[model samples]
Target: MLPDGMTRRDLGWAITGILGVFFAAMISMNVVVTALPVIVSELHGTQIQYSWVVTATLLANASSTPVWGKLADMMSKKTLFQVANVIFFLSSLTAGFAPNMETLIGARFVQGIGLGGLTALAMAILASIVSPRERGRYAGYFGACLATATALGPLVGGITVDTLGWRWCFFVGVPLSLMALVLVGFTLRVPVLEVRGRIDYLGALVLVLTSGALLIWLSFAGTPEFFDWISWESAVLLALAMVLLVFFVMIERRVSNPIIQLRMLVSRTTLLAALSSASIAVCLFGMPAFLGQYFQIGRGLSPTESGMMILPLVLGNLIGTMTTGRLITRYGRWKPYIVVGSLILTCGMFGLATVDSGTPFWFVLTVLVVVGLGFGAQMQNLMLAVQNTVQVTRVGQASALIAFFRVFGGASGTAILGSVMAMQVVGVSVAEVNGTAPSATYADASGTMFLVAACLTLPAVVLNLLIKEVPLRTTI
Candidate 1:
């Protein structure tokens, strides 16, 4: 037996359990992405509603992530992880049975809460046992699971929709999550911190309110064809969002255990890490949500064909993550990977910005590879940077903070970019009604959408360059 009476065989089981939890959470997300167009059309939802169905989960994930992260410190990580799975399965069941756009969106919000628990607690639970340096060694397995989910989710969703129905995309995730719940209960055993502090309900409330309001306002702004951006509706929401944010900061400063410890933000490294994480979030989660539209609507590909096209991106992500994780673990250094990843992000997205309907399949695949490479190199390493700077017990808070920002970035980028995309598409759709070709219109607008994301990558490059490379801890 090892020092804690845990054997090597036990580590293998624990990792399996964690991986299952991740796959259940992540795959359920991507599965719905490609199927969304069909769902919206079937439900007679608008462009804005379509974006909400996806981003609503993300917003809820962002809001509840810290709450779950904090819970890890006060309870059994294993129990919380299993509880999250139950919540996820139930939410998926609710979503699968949703008869309208409103019900589906509501179901997704609940699912996001469950996803927050899985995503945040999984990382925290692993950190509770594994050191940051060694995380790289095992991170490849994590990356592969993530990449596989990303790569296959759309493919499965497309096939399911074509053969069975769109509801199956939501339905299938339930069994997988239930399986993960059972597996984690049987396999995962870890010590909990059991920190003595009251939960920060006010800070949590304001954090969610501010974040939800901001994204909600952006969602409104995205569909300006329905309403003006300068209208009272947008102005009033934006005003409340700002006011809530100010109050959030104040509440955080006074709270015994803030959802996010305000003191952590003072670190230059943490700030850089936050910015870098935000940028990578745009690249990883925000950018990919639109490919189905481009392939099916813009280029007239079949669902299965569009699913096939997603493989290159998934493979690209897998290769990047595997390469970066091994190197970081070996060298115990992460700066070069971050720099290279940022550069790849800028290059890949900028290249994709010029794409049109007739853009070569090979060229698009190549650019997606670069994006995957960049995403792989940056995403996990940024988390490592943040965790290294904090006390071990407080790693949950740090991980949640970085994760919270990623949720913020992913939701905000999708909202803003989705708006830009919808406005342009609707403009051209109106023109199409007046004789413009739908394919040509969508292709041109898609290029502009990518260009906006590409331009956003530049700031991240600057932030990554500025991150102070503090020495990583060699032990937990």
Candidate 2:
């Protein structure tokens, strides 16, 4: 080991490598949201399938996150980190060369598995090295990377799809991932434990089945031929999901080394923070997937112009995230920001609900900026709160659990919103063709989808009110 205490140079290299990996993974996910429409049209996919491209990744990531976290507790984190990178590298290449939508979706699933490992392991490693008090300062820096990636991913992806091709979006992650691999190899080292236990394969299986069934049900709900609640198929799927979830919970209680620890979920701090994290994701991840389409299809703007339109939202997110980080460090409290962020989000979403084809561009931008700010302020605050409450030994479980719920919420939200948009499009299209009035199918879908998105943010505000602010400790 270099020394008992960390040097500034050592910390700098660790933070750089960690943030670089985070930036690359986040960019890879968000970049595709703006490019989805173009990819779907080019590949001749239906709206449901297009939505699955996003949902599949989120589901895969959410499902695998806790497993990675548990593995971090038992294995060498550095070695595991390299394993994730290699998977990401290979998946990117396969995604770039995919001949059809099916193959692309499969590749994206593998990529999500890699992403889940990277995010969970990174946060666990950071927590291991940093104290709770100093973590806020570093959390700010990490938040900045997340905000930058979220903001830039769309603008860059949109431009690339329009100018280069959609395939470049996948290929682009390779070099960034490679750079991260090299940095980690040279700069970071953590002590490895050789402890071993049986992996909770049964619990993992049940959790996957539960999440997958619920997501599939949501995606098909409101589609043309999908089952209604009263229908036999829908009832069976819903019952199966309930059964699997209950079984998973029972398994967790009995297992010595559960994939997800039951004790973590029982903590009030973890429960509230987790629910809040999931709520924020529903709005943050769901809204952007369709907003780019709004600018292009509804307003008739070029892809580049559409990307440019959302820049205010990105800027607002950066400002809000940085501001919250500083305030938390100074006050050592988190509840007020969560409350304020939620209220702001509610106001912004309500404002956005009124958007239509005739709405001014400036008005839309202003509404979205408010939503972005609220999301930025609240999102990572929840994570910080949960991490601080848990012991160092359990930090990996706590961090990964928060991430799991957020991505699970994201996957479900995207599928639900996409289905809603599809139904509206089909309904409007058939009506227009049969009646005297004529309108483009794309325009109707874009306008209606945003209105629905705005409605979804309201529930998040209610959930935010339920989060209790626990005082932060000055020491670990």
Candidate 3:
């Protein structure tokens, strides 16, 4: 930790450097969403291929998180930050120059590896330096940066695709990442924990394979035309994933220093925090992906217009997160926010389920703002709750575990919702052409998707109610 009574500038530089890397990585991931349709159409890739473009990154991210977190615990955070930034920069360049959809997708996978390191390591480092009470203020700032980046990604991506090309969206992240690298090199300093231990190569491999297989299964589950539940290929892949996952658990149990500590997961706080993180991920990531599509396909809006319409959600998120941060610092309790946020989220989602092709744009915007507020209030609070509960030594692992589940949930949620939307559209089209009475040009699938999302969050609300609030730590 920095010397006691460090100047505000010292704090400013550290926070800025960490948040810069986070903003760059998050913006790069989100920018592609609005540009996806244009990118796929230009490259002649199918919708399934388009979905994989996002899923591939998420898969790499989820698999690599524990590895990065372990490395952060064992090595210099400065070294890891530099390495992650360099990898991110190179991958961004490669993606910008990718000649085909396949190459772009491959570049995104590499980018995700770099991003996983930066995000998990950055958070771990911050938590190490700050008291839990003060950490929320900084976490709030980080949340604001994330909200801003997410909000701007689609708008900037739309403009780039319209004027220059979709490739520039990838290029845009390079300078930001470079800036982060420079900031870390100049301003950030943390002692490396030197340790001699064998890396868990087998555990890592099994975990990656298991996660990749599950993601592939989800991606192609309903779209592959052979949704045959009893297919030999499906059974084989499913069995392989389950067996590998079980082996990974066994390996973690035996390792001297596991990549992820399975013991922490048994704690009620950790388990509930992970579940809450996953539920929020499903709500946060699933909505934006489909909202862009809804605007373009269902309502015939341009990419730029669709992005502009979603700005209110971002604004609400910024306000809610910052406010919650101050409130948590003042009250020194977190459970209330979780319960209240989930209930608000449920209400917003229920409202969203009634949206249709003829629904007013204002109504849709209002509901999204409500959803964003709920997210801002709950997302970081859950992580903080988990971080406060764990001892300092295991903080990195605990934090990474929470983030890992959140990303995994997001990836699975997007694939699941996309599949639902695809089936709904197909069913509507088939029925319409078969002489079924049709009053509308096309059925809106967004409402149905929101209903399913609401159902998923209902359980999360119950889980939140059970979370007991522990007092904020006063010292490290």
The sequence of per-residue lDDT tens digits that candidate 2 reaches over residues 1-476 is 23234566876786788788788888888788678777777776777887888888888889989888887777777788789878888987898788889998999999999988988888887777777766777788878888888788888888998889989888777888888888888777665654578988888878888999999888887688575545777788899999999999999999988999988888887887787777678666777767776676666676667777877777778888899988888878778887898888778877877777677888989988998888888888888889999877777788889989989988888888888877877644322232132234555566667666666666666666776777787765
Pick the winner on TM-score between candidates 1 and 2.
1
Number of the top TM-score candidate: 1
Clashing residue pairs in candidate 2 (N, C-alpha, C atoms within 3 angstroms): none
Top candidate, metric lDDT: 1
TM-score of each: 0.95, 0.94, 0.94
Worst 10 contiguous positions by lDDT, candidate 2: 429-438
- TM for candidate 3 is 0.94
**Better model by lDDT: candidate 1 vs candidate 3:** 1
lDDT (10s digit) by residue, model 3, range 276-351: 7888787666677667666655676666876777787787788878989888888887888889988888888899
On the 0 to 100 scale, the lDDT of residue 213 in model 3 is 83
Q: Spell out the clash pairs found in candidate 3.
A: none
Q: What is the lDDT, from 0 to 100, of the residue 464 in candidate 2?
A: 67
- lDDT score at residue 322, model 3, on the 0-100 scale: 91
- Which residue pairs show backbone clashes in model 1? none
